[model samples]
Target: MMKRYYQDEEDIGLFQRMQQDDSQAFEEIYYRYFLKLSNTAFKRLQDRAATEEIIQEFFVNLWLKRHRLPELKNPESYLQTLLRNSVIDWFRSQTRQDGFAAERMAQPDYQIANATEQQILYADLQRAYESTVGQLPDKCRQVYTLHQRGYSVNDIAEQLQIAPKTVESHLLKAHTTLRHLLKDYSAVTITLASLLMG
Candidate 1:
């Protein structure tokens, strides 16, 4: 699906274009990371079919949330985090299936610990996100909140009784302000800036 060479473009440039709904940028990201994400997933699950599903679902979700791409300062790490979450989700779902009991028992203790750590990190990130959003200007925060709740730009505009352009302006401002604040935030909390946007 990649139409042209975007080899010269940096990750940040690609992310910006993807946020604007550029299919080429999305394709570039997919091709660039697909193999790496696949390998990462295979390593954790060790099941060919499950690994493929995880990678496929990750790319689908990535495209669906392209509008939030600009918030990712570290695409590589963020992608890995996404895959890790997917793998954990797969494991959780499999746990409820009788066929997966033996496989779950074969999994290493370290893998279990890793999943626990991920859950803790996500909880902390959610709290930090709420706190950071609280610091935003009122209208900007409301627009961002509604946007995250799946409202389209026009929907947000009509609901807030503001012009669509004003709604867009508020979204852009919120992204910028949140990015700046997250950059200066603690390291453990910093990755949340990129991860929690979606």
Candidate 2:
């Protein structure tokens, strides 16, 4: 029988090279891992378009942070864990948002009245934050939004099939870029600016 190479061994070597900032190695890693990770995520999400988007975002992030990848005992296992967690998290967030909306809808007229200018300003700030986030490179924006929505760096990395260090790097770069872009604004504005500009 011809010797069959274990997938994990190939992954480890590619990951190590990616950590060294080798683009060729990272490309090899992406081709090798993207479909597998996407299929795994899709099994849980059951939304092919969303799952594919998520997987593409993940790989883009991996490329962006290839230099700081951490050593992994088993890349496939780690990715599987990430997909499971992300699916759970996505559902939880949907549940929370639904509950919040329901609660708002159930309020009495007196209790549900709209706010004044201050409240409007706050809302505007929130919108501005979202806008800033929209301005980020697609992958960076996705990572930032995921982080804000409570995904951990590890989870984000796994969902994206990249390294934890790469996640941090995207966040850091996003923050720095946002800070520079919104430095002149007030604290609230700055906060909004960073996220939107990210």
Candidate 3:
């Protein structure tokens, strides 16, 4: 997955205040990204209780390490990377505790783990695509959806009673918007292609 720098001036200012032991700044940061981070964690872990625990631990650690936050360029990216690593560590710990040493040590099980990871990544990409598409203008969304569903531009224009050039314009607008919105999900292009083909 491509790392995203979601930090804007507000995020940076919050982190700076948090580094100074400001409780309100810490709370704001927590509320801002908590749901998003939790959703990402739950998608991978697939266990509500474990996901909550992991997320709580992540926040605790973030608080503990606030003094060093100034060194980081993108705090949101750091949170995402740390959460992903934490989930992987949780899986490994589960494997060890479950006495699956043979499977863990052997090479064959690696394929299963890799496949699961790929599925999780695909799920993330799909969510990003859907979310971004949902944000498009109404006409652009209709045009884009029909186009992706294999409708000819002329067909869409006919169905919507618009000129073909208008259809093309909406499509172009959708592409530009999606490209900007989904830049963080670089693999979404592959997902969209496969989805359209399928």
Candidate 4:
């Protein structure tokens, strides 16, 4: 929930590296946020085991979708949002969403209305994100995915056993394609693109 001034540059750099599949960056992100994410989950579910599972799952999923991740504006907020969604899914799976919805509805009208709108917007954005990413060519998509997850150019080169130039070429094409694909989401194009692609 907090961003340190001194670590801001480092965090951004770390994410950039993670986008390229950097284990060090991935480990740092996990270590740095695991406890915070766990606490946030525990607060929502009040179940220690469930909270741990949710947080761990989120980190793993993030790695799986790293190629699709964008430059995160707020890493903590990003993880919180992921955890919130996970908790909601957990509640639904457990057949508790009805009660949870009722409790949420009992909140002040202003809060409920705002949250509702935000939820709808986020859902739409997520769909659009998937749609756009699904359009990339296979190799470009793979490169984009690997790089966004924190694989540096050289890392991707070594991992893919390709030349660094090839990795950069794929990255360039992926960026260009993504820009053209998401041009219509002018309002959130930049922010969403960053979030969806590192």
Candidate 5:
């Protein structure tokens, strides 16, 4: 008479057969582990639909990569570790996406706030602004910074030993270059740049 096989004996036999590419053994393993793996993932993710999707993906990858799977001293521990790592990766990706979305939503509001601040701070739009200051002719840049620091155009002209008309020309040229360079940005980028310069 043949002896009866215990369920654990059946499982070990299935596992050994799986190493030899036995489809039935692989299906048996899947049936045994799927519920436990899904439950573990669900505990971490909380969302039923997302948890189900994650577990399904995990098992599919497991089957696809079965040949490369390591020899396990404890198959259950190995599976649980894989599930935990998958859940951790899912949460990490969710955090990064949330941060990016928040930054995008805040950008326009940040621009608006910056514009309100810039209105009180500087005048002359060209030479007084940092973006265009660097692009000016060397003497123009020096005269502009003096005017930005509260010197009159005449005072800048006297201090730099240039004509007042030369100071005006430098300021105008600086402004024109800034407008050209910044034309591609939205109003928000302009405001933000102004705030940063200030």
Candidate 6:
């Protein structure tokens, strides 16, 4: 199951399989988006059965039309938007009779978790970031610290009495090294990746 599931990670591979009506590939996508979409729908509908039915139907329709779908730059995002639209349609259909859709729509969207989870995530990110940075070579760490402190390349070079090219070199090397160290941490990955030259 793990080996089969891995085959669908790449968008191109998944797209190819769906073209041939591969159910395993379809199942992989179904499970990937199921929780997120179900949560989104339940946020609005507040009905577990209705949410499940809507998402189930959406996936059913998706499988039927998979082969003819056009190129998708981001399949996950596309599916998410589709799920949101499906929820909205559910709301509209219910509204014709209930007329209470607007109030429901005004409620907060589905949050993955509460404030405590957010704090824990932030702390984990900070630890991962600091630990990765702490593992850098002396010069690379120096350059990165200064860069984060708002130092320009030329300013960092001058302050450290190093060549501007050397400063850039250290930053690039640090970026690559930290990326490897922090690959499993999305927040850290984004923070480190954002250090590229403007």
- Tell me each candidate's TM-score: 0.49, 0.42, 0.47, 0.44, 0.44, 0.46
> In terms of lDDT, which candidate is strongest?
3
RMSD (Å) per prediction: 12.5, 16.5, 14.5, 13.3, 30.5, 13.9
Q: Write the per-residue lDDT of candidate 2 for residues 149-170, one digit (tens) a residue.
A: 6577889999999888788768
**Off by more than 4 A, model 3:** 1-9, 100-198
Q: Please give the lDDT score at residue 17 for candidate 5.
A: 66
lDDT of each: 0.68, 0.60, 0.69, 0.64, 0.60, 0.65
lDDT of 5 by residue, 55-121 (tens): 6667656656767878777777777898888899898877677676768646988767655554433
lDDT of 5 at 77: 76
RMSD of 1: 12.5
Q: What's model 1's lDDT at 143?
A: 97
Query: Residue 4, candidate 6: how far off, in angstroms?
Result: 3.2
- Give lDDT tens digits, candidate 1, residues 1-198: 113456446567787888887767766676556545665676576565576567766777787788765587877788888888899999999768775666765689857875676556545545666787898899999998897665778899999999987987786677556555444322422232244343
Give model 6's TM-score versus the native structure. 0.46
| Angstrom error at residue 5, model 6 | 4.5
Q: How do the residues 1-198 of candidate 4 rate in per-residue lDDT, one tens digit apiece?
A: 222222223466777777897655765676456544654665566554565567656776777787788778777667778888999999877664578766766789957685676556545645665676788788778887897675667888898888987877786676556546434433332333354466
* CA lDDT for candidate 5: 0.60
Report the poorest 10 consecutive residues by lDDT, candidate 5.
1-10
Candidate No. with top TM-score: 1
- Model 6 misplaced stretches (Cα beyond 4 Å): 1-8, 98-198
Candidate 5: the clashing residue pairs are: 126-175
lDDT of 3 at 88: 94
List runs of model 2 lying over 4 Å from the truth.
Answer: 1-9, 99-198
Compute the lDDT of residue 34 as modeled in candidate 6: 54
Instruction: State each candidate's clash count.
Output: 0, 6, 0, 23, 1, 0
Query: Which regions in candidate 5 have their CA more than 4 angstroms from the true location?
Result: 1-12, 98-198
